[model samples]
Target: MITDLIAGLFMIAGTFLMFLAGLGLLRMPDLLMRMHATTKAGAMGIGLVMIGVALHFLEAGVTARVLIIVLFVMLTAPVAAHTIGRAGYFVGVPLWEGMLKDELKGRYDAETHTLASPPEHQNKEP
Candidate 1:
């Protein structure tokens, strides 16, 4: 049936994303880059896989559960990644040598563990 083909395509795409996430984890030089890749790709892959499952099942209960799971993951993954990255930075994790600009360089206060807002002058648009 057409539904089955669509489901298969979704699952394959999801699996490919998951594989790319793993590859990124292994290949990325620094913690933040790896986290960015894994979190974005992994969350999307799971969402797609769950959507495919929901479509294939064609049952209300199964679809509802899948939707809940995907929504929860999509909401939480980025937040969790951010928390982890922030913690790592605070703990003295070194960034990659080739990194160009550190936007947080002067804004983050190591003593207070807080980020100060940019000056009002800089906030104004050109």
Candidate 2:
């Protein structure tokens, strides 16, 4: 009974997170921001849903499979988002106007298609 209640809660939480993620994707103005929404919230939502399923099953095989699904989603989502963001950045996608700083500015060389981290001294804020 307790397990069922807990599973239901987790399922609800997952649904809410996924809904928020969809809202974020629609509301955010930039590619990076949308990516952030989908990656973080979507991954978490899927993970929670999988956890709920595993809990409901309470079987070794099903639990293991669901756990693997959760792990895979958590691991891949961030990497996929980062890769897409980097591609967008390299292709000259503009950041949102309200952005405070551009840490990557001057670090990428269009001519050579190369990127490098700024020097230690340049990393500090005034």
Candidate 3:
């Protein structure tokens, strides 16, 4: 009885998280921010939903399948997001104006490019 209620509640929570993930994807601006929203909310949404489903099923094979599904999502989602984000950067997507600092920008600038390449280094050139 109590377990059923708890499982029901988890299902509801997971559904709400999935909704929020959709909202976040629609609302967030820029590639990086969108990816962040997609990764965080998407992972939690799918994870909790899978857990709720496992609870509902409550049998060996079904639960094991759910666990496998969760593991796959966990492993793949971040890698997909990182690949997309890196590709977006390479393709020259403009960042949102609100970004106060970019650690990647500093690292890429300092470690690569030349004093004559572009932007920050151009000023240092003769």
lDDT of each: 0.93, 0.93, 0.81
User: What number of backbone clashes does candidate 2 have, counting pairs of residues 3 or more apart or in separate chains?
Assistant: 0
Candidate 2 residue lDDT tens string, 1-126: 999999999999999999999999999989999999989899999989888998898999999999899989988899999999999999999899998888889889999999887798877999
Backbone atom clashes (below 3 Å) for every candidate: 0, 0, 0
Query: In candidate 3, what residue range of length 10 has the lowest lDDT sum?
Result: 109-118
What is the C-alpha lDDT profile of model 3 across 13-109, one tens digit per residue?
8788878878888898889988888887888888888888888878999899989998998899999999899877756699999989765564344
Report clash pairs, candidate 2.
Answer: none
How good is model 1 by TM-score? 0.93
Best by TM-score: 1
The segments of candidate 3 whose C-alpha lies over 4 angstroms from its true place after superposition are 106-126
TM-score for each candidate, following the candidate numbering: 0.93, 0.92, 0.80
Model 1, residue 57: displacement in angstroms? 1.1
Q: Which window of ten consecutive residues has the lowest lDDT sum in model 2?
A: 114-123
lDDT of 3 at 47: 85
